[model samples]
Target: MVRASAGRIWSVSSNPCQDQIHYAQLNWDEDGQPLSSVFGDVYFSRVNGLEETRHVFLQHNQLAQRWEALPEKVHFVIAETGFGSGLNFLAAWELWLTTAPRSAQLHFVSVEKFPLDKNDLIRALALWPELEFLSQQLIDAYPCIVGEGFHRLSFMDGRIKLTLIINDAARGFSKLLTTTDPLYSQYSAKVDAWFLDGFAPSKNPQMWSEDLFSCIHQLSNAGTSAATFSAAAIVKKGLKFAGFAIEKVTGFGRKREMLKAIMPNNSQDYFYPQPAYKSASTFPSSWSINTNLDIYPDKHALIIGAGLAGCSSARALAERGWKVTLLERNNAIASEASGNPQGVLYAKLSYKEEAQAEFNLTSLQFAQSFYSSHWANIGKKTGVLQLAHCDSEQVLQTQLQEKFAAADELVQFVSCTKASEIAGVPLSFNAIYFPNAGWINPAKLCEQLVSHPLINVVTGIAAFNIQRTEHGWCINNDRELQAPVVIIANARDAQHFEQTQHLPIKSIRGQVTYLPATIASKEIKTVICSEGYIAPASAGIHCTGATFNLKEESKELRVEDHQTNLENLREPLQELLAEWENSDKHSLDGRVAFRCTLPDYLPAVGPVADEPAMLHSFASLRKNARAFIQDTGKYLPGLYLNIGHGSRGLAYTPLCAEILAAHINNEPQPIARDLVNALNPARFLIRDLIKNKR
Candidate 1:
């Protein structure tokens, strides 16, 4: 086996219509009906297949039996290949979640090359109404990972993780074998049961080859067990060759035979004890449940301001077994600059294949899916349109359209007439219409975010000092509150702490105007962004303005910013307002707040600590990084953060919270692992001091 950890590989271009290729392409005959491969393997060979899965995979895998058998709580790992349509995975997951004991954790590891787009996935899974919610979750988080990387998604807090390896079987299993590269390898997975569900060997030769069987052999333990609908003799021979003693059984559907295999030998001889995942120590617990599990999870996540960053972080942590304590010093959330009645969910694109624009586009899509799935109760799918005012804008849009070459349904070139019609307001220039974009109630969203059961929200609490403790950290307010983890999400107040005093967090104050939606306003159905934004009337309030005044950090409404917004939302709105001849400027209500923004725009997450350690560790970065300890060890111990959401908070928070949780849970991250390290709080310390010769 060519074994040294391989270097980076070039990415295969994905099908423009979907994130990856379509699995159906391999399963269907020319008529697109269920046809076997040349070897005659049906995609789903089980009749009442769903029931058969529950009975065999679930019951035999001893799911209900296992749960009932548990003397103490533990986690179960069920791995699979070819997660086509996710029916089997979802059904199994539903059983685990609903029927399994609350204390039990289920890890469903599956590999998939082709993943369906959301609309189609949602449509396909509609058949299984019982698994609707679970399916929606899988579909929503269906990673758009293009190349070969493990896209780990969290479900049921940190308990269930979908370790979606988005590559061919041979490569994915090879990487899995090396997961314990001798570090942080505790709990490196060995499948308890493998659900083999790839297309027939004849149809997809690469998937069912000897190399694939070799991977299974190298990756699994001697006791590892697997099941498949295929009873083909070649399959039996391959399993036997791979060291798995195979046996034919009653098959599903019209098939009279199926196969199950088990490697009945001691695997512990090859197994190296993994210590990284196993905590070096455990906390003293008053009860058994608390002793074995993270019952006293780190709580008291502080969000100083009720703006996007704080609220979003608070919401994410709160949902995932963390006790979020949001401290807004103010009387209400989003009273600050994020108090806008409506904020546009716009995706910026560049003509020159810009990095920033690409990031924004992906962020926009992730954000939309995040909200649509997580916060659908409060979200509106009005979509956002970026107006192209001039020839330069048009040129950039056209070039970007070609460079992206993604699903055309994502973004479309709308002429003035169509743009005007879609906007529900008249338009003067052509624009790019993002059909999935819309505006959100920032404050309402915050309220929703902090409303989780695990979250204990206290407003009007002014934090004076934050000091670390043996148990956790202390919040110096009325008396003192203890928490294992603390997040300084209080915008400008975050700077008051000694650990973060060097951070470049600043407050930007702004004001927004709220007007009544007229029949003329009905024309502005979608969010329209130029210099400023105008959103469709929500709850009878037509939101406009949002003039950015960097110097004014006060919460008082200013006419200048309003006038600035008026000009920014120009074109049709300008004419409509002037034509109304309504000299009354007070026809709109105004509000203001401070926006805590970082200089470089990226957030300060993970840990906070002395910068000197960071600088010293990464000191050799200016020269050859490999010559020294280039990556700074995580700065703070037991202390981490999730802040600096900025204006992109709506677009960034869901993933940001995910990053924070993954770090704390030691699970795979939602963002690129490199990006996670890049966003580390100690990153700037290393860059400015260690990597900088100047």
Candidate 2:
């Protein structure tokens, strides 16, 4: 670990991606304090960890005072270095809950290279019985695999949000600081307080490197305060050089002294001036405006459609202090595309590392973890087995396993014999088993999402006539409703809006047949998918097929669709198909639904553009594709869209909703830059312009 010089940018170290996490080797000292064998340092004060955390972190930072004085609906952010046993985080959360206004939110961001496993966390948290209530929630929501990425966990009905980045301190802080994604813009890479809780400078010197301090300085606002148990010369010098005014403080228990520091009020000198967004030369144009401008107003949003997209979007925005009004034409939520009894959490992965495949993999993992926390009993963790039906599919599966470097937790290739044993059924072919994949009840998930206190769902009202008013956009019908921001999330019906009519959204009709689970068929444990899929028994029946038809519109259950389902089931459940074929046609039950999709099959998320205005502005892109234009594009101010998820609604909608929330809040996005562009609703127009097809 090299030290960073003042006025010199420190380069981030290479990722420790493949390195196994070094768990803390705990040893009890004579005084009964937990000691780390690797670092040879105490985990906390020998006298008391809880009191030390409150004094060294909370008192020095004045968290309780700051939290009490916070403005309404504001989010107070605290970033910590080493969240060993999360003592600091727990103390802060408890203080915030007691001191802050009910409407204010607390966002605690922590970086940990080596997180304790569930059992370890439980054991360690047991030391603080007073914090048992909060610790239990964290334990329940903790990531099982602890994969490399940001894991966001919300508690207290979304009032408290914890974003745990499991990575090296320097690497995580650097990645976070460099992100231009809108989801993180809310804080501008600044935090209110810092908990420099790594082991003592002598014991774990690597964690207190100058690079780490420099990164911390970069993420701190002018008034950021930090406290640490170490008052070593290097610790003090690094923080002082990085722009914080430091002082030695009285230490807890037997410790001689600790350090406390605060960035000066005028300490903007640490950061370079933010440069403008680099407009893509081939990107579409619209009414010229600043690309970095945020358009959200008054923290209120009106969302059309109450299905998965709408409800998820509503929940995301509501968590961010936005009051959302969700409108559905049907008398109840999820009465359309999201009304399926069981939706499989399928990834639909590809061999090619394209945007779709990458997005699917990440979204699958996020949704699986997210559903386990939010949708608990409504979903099953029975892994999904995707069999290779053709030569091309077999090649793709092989590539996915070998070339793409898929992890066993995410997916693994299995032979016919292995697949049969895993599924508890006689299988025909080899498969890719997604261990994290499962099945969810779409309607139930939607119901849970809209139940948030910040979301006001109004069903049985069709918002047909919409007009841009001086106040905001107003929806007119028997009743008039208005909000500063509006989101179209009604799947295919989004096209009913004049602004969205130009969108190439196609509604594909589909039907899923349900077969009564027999003693033999009930043995089918995992969801088996080839051309079609069959979920494990739910309510004494298994959901199967989903005959896709582009032209069909009628919702009536067709006898032929059931036959098609039976035929599709023969390959996977050979014996069960014979029994089902012999049953009465009327006994065959199923659900008919429409899946909204785009020409390119990606969901239309993010901001909506003024299509005609953009076309007129960037029409020349058709002639000169390489021309660099200053204008990115013009989005209808405060207007956004989250639709066209197709059949992977369960897998895609949650992440898409998060993306929409990020755009609305002008925060950093969770996904990469290119992937964010792929979900842009204006991409179709940009493609048409580049192809000279306007």
> How accurate locally, in lDDT, is each candidate?
0.61, 0.77
How do the residues 1-694 of candidate 2 rate in per-residue lDDT, one tens digit apiece? 2121122111122344434444456665554456676677767887889999998999988888888898777777788888877878888989988999898778788888766655566767888999999998888777643234566667786688777776677766655652333223223436778888887878778778877877777777678888888789988988887789998989888878988999997665534333433433223333222154454548899999999999999999888789999999999999888988888998777655478866886687668867866546566889999998779888888766543342555678899999999999898899889887888888888888887788999999888867777766888733358887889998998888988888999999999998899988899999999878999998898988788899679999999999997888777777877788899977788999999999988999987888887887677788977565545566787778999999899999988988787677644455554566778888888788889988
Predicted candidate 2: what Cα RMSD to the true structure?
Answer: 6.3
Name the lDDT of candidate 1.
0.61
TM-score of each: 0.75, 0.81
- Report the number of the highest-lDDT candidate: 2
Error at 44, model 2, angstroms? 3.5
Model 2 pairs whose backbones collide: 181-668, 182-667, 182-668, 183-667, 183-668, 183-669, 184-667, 184-668, 185-667, 185-668
**Cα lDDT of model 1 by residue, 358-471, tens digit:** 345556655665676444656577877788875777777776654444444457787889988888767888888878667877777877777778776777877777777777
RMSD of each: 8.3, 6.3
